[model samples]
Target: MTLPVDPDLRPVSVATADGSGAHYWVWGDPAATTTVVAVHGFRGDHHGLLPIVVGLDDARVVTPDLPGFGVSAAFDSGPHDVDAYAAWLTTFCRQLHRTGDRLVVVGHSFGSVIGAAAVAGGLCPDALVLMNPIAAPALAGPRAVLSTIALGYYRAGARLPESLGNALLTNPVIVRALSEVMAHTADPALRSWIHDQHRRYFSSFADRRVVVEAFEASVSHDIGEYAARISVPTLLIAGDRDDIVPVAAVQRLAGELTDSRLLVLADVGHLIHYERAEPAAAAINEFLARRLGGSTSGRP
Candidate 1:
């Protein structure tokens, strides 16, 4: 799953007042008047959104590696929760946005929680797109038990010697298992690519404390409160096969939002963008055009 980097795309860093910075990839003209800011989910980086990026045309896109993942610095100040992330993102957007410029904010998985918080906190993006939004932890059936076991194991692993814990988390077998569990697609090629990506990048998140804290924060708070307050037009994408964030929860979230439309992908799962990038991107493009009044055609 090696993607071609756009010739105009380059790595950029946005420094915070606290001396730490967030790193991201930028695509399209550097001086574009409108920007799409995409945030990756838990255990993901800018690479996770490459397929979606390919489908976007006619606008500048910026994808950031949230605080503790990818090449970005860890959140050394407050808890890695929605509120803290929203605050950081507000600053990051302010740095990128010029007067009279338009913005569309997109978030995947846990990133959606942060996006909702940011909008509720008055970040003021013109449109919001939430892909595979997780309203709460999937605490049903065997998956619930497995999730509990995984958390317990993580807590125990954290207590081991630092080197031992890191080695345990980064083990090839464990990484492969974790990656496979995140997907529901039957496409062998796509599954293989996802496993490889997760083994190489997702499992290599070096900060154990940040990993545990972020995991806890992801399922702790309900985004419904923020959803109710969000005034921006929103497109909510859900995968019917998503075990972690079921379509039922997504429907409930849509009901809670002030203005939104929910799209359920029949055979897709948590990795909506990865499994169905073309359709995902098309859906996003349509949303941007119809809801946000942007361009009609998208990129290849």
Candidate 2:
């Protein structure tokens, strides 16, 4: 769905502990009582979450291009593993949070894993929303064969020379193939837009090393591993048709969390942010209202 008008977005940047700059965009009112930090999936920037941001008119939304993606610089030290990303997220939220603001974390796909890890590691947001969360190992999912092939693809990209590796990783053909596989929508226009979106932003990573390391991190961990440790009320929005993490896995993840609600969308696949943004946002708004008692005004 196209937004009637572009949301007013303000660009902001912060220096992380690792010395890399975390670049982000702020949407909605700055003084809004609720603040949301929306994290995008692997190889994507802030643009992936814009549809949700547009629907969340009552809260201030912060969409960050995680370190090593989009305009953000890569970490000066350490591998781009779950722990490193969790630490970076902790520092990023702490720096952006303010007095009297209710902070909420919204993550999609790989970002959901990062959010869960960060929350389990002591990044305390008032509430958490995970869209298309990685609730099970990619290798164990129904798409295991694809996952294995992707593992090798990333490995080859990492080992190749810089120019060749970048070319292979960012190839339009491969990006479109991945997009077509994940996008379950039947609407031709929407499917085309999804492919275009992937073609546009799926290769914005800092370098081959960062993308490969991030891919390893994405496949290495799942939200279920950290669910029991998370104390905050959480919302899990899953596409029933998701091939990466099945709906059953997400239900199991909800049972593992201390307090969580699961919403499964029918006929939707892993590309909920692209195909089912309106429903996802509606659920998120309802969750925030019920759990955090925030404003529902369409002020933004």
Candidate 3:
């Protein structure tokens, strides 16, 4: 990915409060055209796509591990809804030294939906790059059913029996299924680190309190309807063979956004940035060059 601009960047704490626990990594020169805030997918940590962010030499990179992941694992809060995430983003952005108004949020999978919801609710960054984004309708099938059921179980366990939260979180079958979904990586260290993050899962402050509340708040989170509200350029990238997010969601997004572009690549997986790093980096660089007042001199 463009020779890995900041090849071995280190992670640092970025939150101003203990309750707001967040770890981040900054790549490239800070005085670039714009800063890219890369959000990781579900169960992923901050360093998940370091290579992808570092590849774009002309842009500054800022990545965070949301609560329940990475160094923010100890962050116990009210709920993990889009509003909370969006608020955290706003708070964090204001803290960036001399960041100066230009922002481009690039979210992957679950992060994309959350970012879209954030953008809709006025977290309006300059541009949105959704990679293998999870659209509302695509998550309306078995995934939704399972999510709703989990929330219900988490909620009910508080009143009736204390089985749901513990059982589901530690359930062998469910764990196996989740593990399978994360089986895309072959690196032992990376896989082990991610699996540990997943295994750190326990009952939240309340069973499914945060997730259930987030699910409700995120019910009508349609990125398309909000895409029109986004006052910025946008890009939607999808891998036809993504295991978690369907490519059709990207197609739906393309039809919804007024100033947006779509790029579909074959033989790539859900974690396109991690799997096909070079091409993904090229696409991102090319996009910024064409849309963000930069020249397409050396960009692919």
Q: Which residue pairs collide, candidate 1?
A: none
lDDT of 1 at 183: 78
Candidate 3, after superposition: displacement of residue 245 in Å? 3.3
The local lDDT score (0 to 100) that residue 209 gets in candidate 3 is 47
Give the Å shift of residue 284 in candidate 1.
Answer: 0.7
List, residue by residue over 249-270, the lDDT tens digit for candidate 3. 6787787777888999777657
Off by over 4 Å in 2: 3-10, 14-17, 294-300
What are the lDDT scores of the predictions, listed in order?
Answer: 0.78, 0.88, 0.64
- TM-score for each predicted model, relative to the true structure: 0.91, 0.95, 0.74
Model 1, residue 11: displacement in angstroms?
Answer: 1.9
Kindly indicate the candidate among 1 and 2 with the higher TM-score.
2
Compute the lDDT of residue 106 as modeled in candidate 2: 95
Model 3 RMSD in Å is 5.0
lDDT of 1 by residue, 1-300 (tens): 446475234566665634457777777656656688898888788888888877876778888878888877887677677788888888888787667767888899888888888889989998889998876654443367766777776676678899898777667888787778777878899899888777666864548877777777676655675877898889999899887776777888899888899888888889987898888888888888887564622322
